[model samples]
Target: VHHGNGTEEILGSDSRFLFISSHTRGQAFYPGTGAESWKNVLNVPLSLGFSADDFLREWSEAGVPGRIAAFQPQLIILSAGFDAHRDDPALGGRLETEDFLRLTEHMVSLAWGIESCHGRLLSVLEGGYDTSVPTPHRQRGGALQRSVEAHLKGLVSSSRLPSNFTSSVLGKRKKPQCGSIASV
Candidate 1:
């Protein structure tokens, strides 16, 4: 989950939209948003050194999936952000690569469960800037590459539903045009 403040601000009062963000809080981070009081938004703000366990617990306890199910959104847009990874200096979130996988899997399952979603999902890359130095820089390039690879793999792997199910659900959509980007 990304710090989707603008999204929340735009769609907060709209019942059809459920905006959720998991990000670091109280440290005067960039953009400085994602407060808990926003309407129709679920903001899980973590302290420095927050781990995956804390994230999982907050996700489960917040009932994010259940909230989405109740909202029954016809489309799901994911702003996948990886700056929360421990190796990322920008936001020191301490999340492992596998945590991103699990997060993606959960979103995939949630989208699948909604009849209106019809496997209609769009993923926009939002964050994850590795600001570490270049000279002995194992953390910047290597970690960014590995994190991106893992995130893509998780998305691809989770999107592979049974062919029959995919055909039946997605047949109603318009044919894909060249150069158009969409996620299943």
Candidate 2:
């Protein structure tokens, strides 16, 4: 919902840590400090309620990929914020659960290309406010849960054989089984 102003403040100037953030800016967004890129911090601000295609385009065409490749850091950490989900009311980000999986897959592939980041990836759950109360029948969880599962699936997809794609991801994936899911 907000920008990583603290992270940028501490490590933004450090050449060892390259921070690339795609967040909503130039509007009534929170913090209001990441409107421009500086030093190691590459801020790609977009309009409020940005679509999935627009977000992906910023990574694909907006020089993010190029910058990441040029840096070639030893480790890659995804501050996996699910507030961007369409169902999330916090940040007007419109992205499906599948989109998170696809993005994770792409990131994993990108990491694979970097010899320093040879699968040394850490996905830390950051922001997600799917505050909608679920009904009795809809006890199967909300978009945040789905997004986390998709992200986890993406993380594990690389190790799984290509032939077991469909069967491997079947059945219910609980939060505790993967990691702790802090509820808002």
Candidate 3:
């Protein structure tokens, strides 16, 4: 139940209230932000890896209800990111897009508990440098684009699935958990 747009007009009567945003400062990517304020901001200009667990923990502490709670949200719009993927060249986030799916599922579960926002969630594209790098390997930005596309496709499929999907995927594979400061 979060929308990132800075415009008060978009929210109608609900404008200026309950809306939150966390985005890069300048127009480093597409959909430039004219926003002047943000309720929750993780403002790291270029690269700052936002780990899934970190997001969950911070959000949980933000006083909002857990991911699975019955709340009435007009709509929950997520600003999806693929640059955080471990493979992306633009960012050093190192987050697997699956983490994004898990987060999405978490929000969706919360919505399901509430009769108001059950199916009213809306997701909007924000920033992802994975799609437009300039190089030979980035022919038409195909290499990273394809990988991100695959990752996003996987995320979509996973979102439709149950939360056990995350447990199952992580259960089969084991990888070191590293925390790095640089975004890339």
Candidate 4:
């Protein structure tokens, strides 16, 4: 989710793909892009200490689900970056492990809504470099393990959830007015 500029640069404006990213926004951040001026890229830039609630709100405001529905992507590629987790010191964003699950669930629901998607989702881990020495309460690998496990479990749970469940959750929401794009 952090610094998806390269992907956006590659696919942005090419209606065949819809590029969406949620990341820290500031001139100080690395690869300082994802600004509001970027066209064809749905960038949800947030300040430091952004929590899961903030993330979800931003996602909804950005009309992510409607964008997905409009695009009707045949497949979804998630550049999963866990460095945004509060425990990870590499990035300043304060997302917790459970936040990842919620985000995954939203994406899964979006995938389920589109006929072409058919739940075709691929998650490729990108960041998270908190692997260091161990402590009494927590270990170097523990956070990574927990985050990965949570993501996997969330995906499984999302897949098992009834289609009606997704409809029930998303049905009340109004359709976004954003334009559609071609399939990736």
Best by lDDT: 2
lDDT of each: 0.70, 0.74, 0.48, 0.72
Model 2 clash pairs are none
Tens-digit lDDT track of model 2 for 1-184: 4677888888887888999777777656677667778768888887788877888887677688778878888899888888888888775688888889888888877776676666567989987787444688777567888888788877766443233334443435422232332332
Candidate 2 Cα deviation (angstroms), residue 67: 1.0
- Candidate 1 lDDT over residue span 87-139, tens digit each: 77665678887787777766767777788786667778777777444466454
Q: Stretches of candidate 2 above 4 Å error?
A: 131-135, 159-184
Q: Poorest 10 consecutive residues of model 1 by lDDT?
A: 175-184
Please provide the root mean square deviation of candidate 3 (C-alpha atoms, Å).
10.2
Q: For every model shown, what is its TM-score relative to the native structure? A: 0.76, 0.80, 0.51, 0.78
Off by over 4 Å in 4: 37-39, 132-140, 158-160, 163-184
lDDT of 3 by residue, 1-184 (tens): 1124443345424522344444333555334453343343222232245566766665566545532233346676655545556567655454665676566666656654565554445665654555655687745453345444443443344345445544554576442122211121
Ranking by TM-score: 2, 4, 1, 3
Better of 1 and 4 by lDDT: 4
Candidate 3 overall lDDT versus native? 0.48
Q: Between candidates 1 and 4, which one is better according to TM-score?
A: 4
Q: Name the candidate, 3 or 4, with the larger TM-score value.
A: 4
* 134 Cα displacement, candidate 1 (Å): 11
> Distance (Å) between predicted and true CA of 159, model 3?
7.9
